[model samples]
Target: ALTTMAKWEGGRAVDARAAETGETPLMAAASAGQLDCCLSLLTAGADPLAVNVDGVGILALVASKVSQGKRSKVRAVVRLALLNAAPQLRVLLLHHEDCGRHISFKPHQESPERISAILAFIAKGATIGLFSAEELLVSTEFDQASKEHLIRCHSEEYISVITQLGEQVANTPVAFTPYYQGFKGLPQAKQKKAEFSDTFFSPGTMAAALRAAGGVVHAVESVLKGHSRTAFVCVRPPGHHAGVDGATAGAPSSGFSIVNNAMIGALHALEGNHGRLCKRVAVVDFDVHHGNGTEEIARAWHAKHRKAGARAASGADESDLFFASIHLADDGAASSIEFYPGTGTRDDLHHNIVNVCVPPMWIGAGAGGRGSVSA
Candidate 1:
């Protein structure tokens, strides 16, 4: 019922308070140890600070009930509600240390530069009173994603290969694939050769990748549980280029990406890792490059379960996975948007995928035959 109300598009006001008592829906839920109900109301824009006739807020009532059986759950509800009640939406910022150390010659694309720039932007926002530092909960403490979790979104073969390559990098600091050897092979005299690709991994790369994946999963849980309405996972090496197809799907050194962080997090959400069942999930990728890996993971999982659902009437069924990508087209065709990986197109649209094909330079139509430009 709460989900239906949340999805309702009609703008009709629902009375949150009673005629005489003035208690809110949130207060009632919190008082009863109904964490889910509290979350639902919070998602629907319920004012967490709504007070009753006695002048006690919903949070106070929830705190008063913390000594009950569902102590932790009630406390979590109160914390999440407090966060939501803030004037500005609280933001959780997570990053791994290895992200900042992963330097590259790719100018603005380097890990340290990019991560530092983002931190600076956040600091600026805080300094300007846009949001308080407490609202921006920054953390580096996240468990590394386990192999069991990784296998859920990636092929066994890909996982094995990436693991081997990461081990090699740890042991020897240099490894060779069919095309080229990683950075350790390049000498100080060969500075130009090292600038060729930023995707190469070192010994610590896998740990960083796992932590990055972990941060995103944690963020998703935080948001879904009403802990925070927003979270930003800032980590590198980037994973959108590391997908489930071609030679790079599971390869640790593919496109400067080691693990598909987005897909891993999505898998966690679907699997109810945080104890919340997400029947329908959508991954919107705004990266400049197409999120082929995320697309592959979502589609393949959906198809696998869908086939099982048809055969065994009572088995695990497929959940709806919506994958949308707005990025540079891979085709050189004269057409406005020529999709690569051949998965996203108007004719080939799936119930789960929506591809918005647009030209590289054509940044939407504007007045007077002018178009806004972006890099």
Candidate 2:
């Protein structure tokens, strides 16, 4: 790839390559939204910041010319390409060595397309236009909210952490590695280090994901109020983890989820007054894991702001506030409210939890059972 790519230079096309095209393959790939090709070429020696006679550098062409919404995908491709080729990234955000690396190259704004792909997975249950945004004169998307909420919600310690990740995303995409180290914990320290070195959150690292969550809940409220019937909060950092105190090893959670988007959604589902959230709401947590953070935070929020005599208990009994999850209970027999089963199990959170204590084979006993009522 390197030997074949010796033609382009100094933001201008060389004569022999000029016959092929004024720009190189890398530049062409950007325009075509061939993110993989572009990233590969760039990593292999193509110029990300190179420009030709048309005042079009590879990044510029991608930003201005390529179609919208495909940018993130293109970027995701770009990230993959970077990771696959480079043996090591000294600074995931600042490649002090990319030939096309720019002192004045400037940062690239995230493409809506890339953001949307993440949104699709994160906000699967939300209804886009009607349920969430129909009643209001304006449609509430999380783009701006994402930017705003994160700035407000995250702690300085937390913000600093994610901010660095964002920087890594900005500078050079990290190669995707498995969550575990052969047979151990995730590469969190590396992730955290990159996040800090890169300044990910300061400019809106995890905030965008937060905004989408809050916005989605607001949409849900609109529906419950008979305003809209459906809507979706296309957001990320899918916030279902992050328990009340802080994140720990056992429970499965995104460190980002410490602030939790779903919890925000549940809060907005309720009625609020005096700039405070107040109401009874049900959080249908269908995500694979039990949404402990949402449950934890909602309970806390209720304790502080719920109306006097309005709630059944002094905020402890959340039977009225629906928080249910279709998850395998990890805490063995300790998985109960009394036990506060928020921490993750000391084992592989079961994928299929069979109540082995009492069971028969396919000759089932209840509900959709195939057998007779009596043994």
Index of the highest-TM-score prediction: 1
lDDT of 1 by residue, 140-220 (tens): 877778886788787776677667766665432332223233222434453334445445556666767777778888888
lDDT of 1 at 77: 54
> Model 2: per-residue lDDT, tens digit, 95-197?
0011111111124332234444544543452354222211113343323234334332234555444455445555433321222111134565534344222
Q: What lDDT score is found at residue 205 in candidate 1?
A: 64
Q: What is the lDDT of residue 199 in candidate 1?
A: 54
Best by lDDT: 1
List the candidate 1 regions with Cα displacement exceeding 4 Å: 1-89, 101-108, 170-195, 245-253, 273-276, 310-316, 335-348, 362-375
**lDDT values for all models:** 0.62, 0.41
C-alpha TM-scores of all predictions: 0.64, 0.38
TM-score of predicted model 1?
A: 0.64
**Model 2: number of backbone collisions:** 23
Against the true structure, what is every candidate's RMSD?
11.5, 22.2
Model 1 global lDDT (CA atoms, 0 to 1): 0.62
- Candidate 2: stretches off by over 4 Å: 1-143, 146-204, 245-258, 271-279, 302-320, 331-375
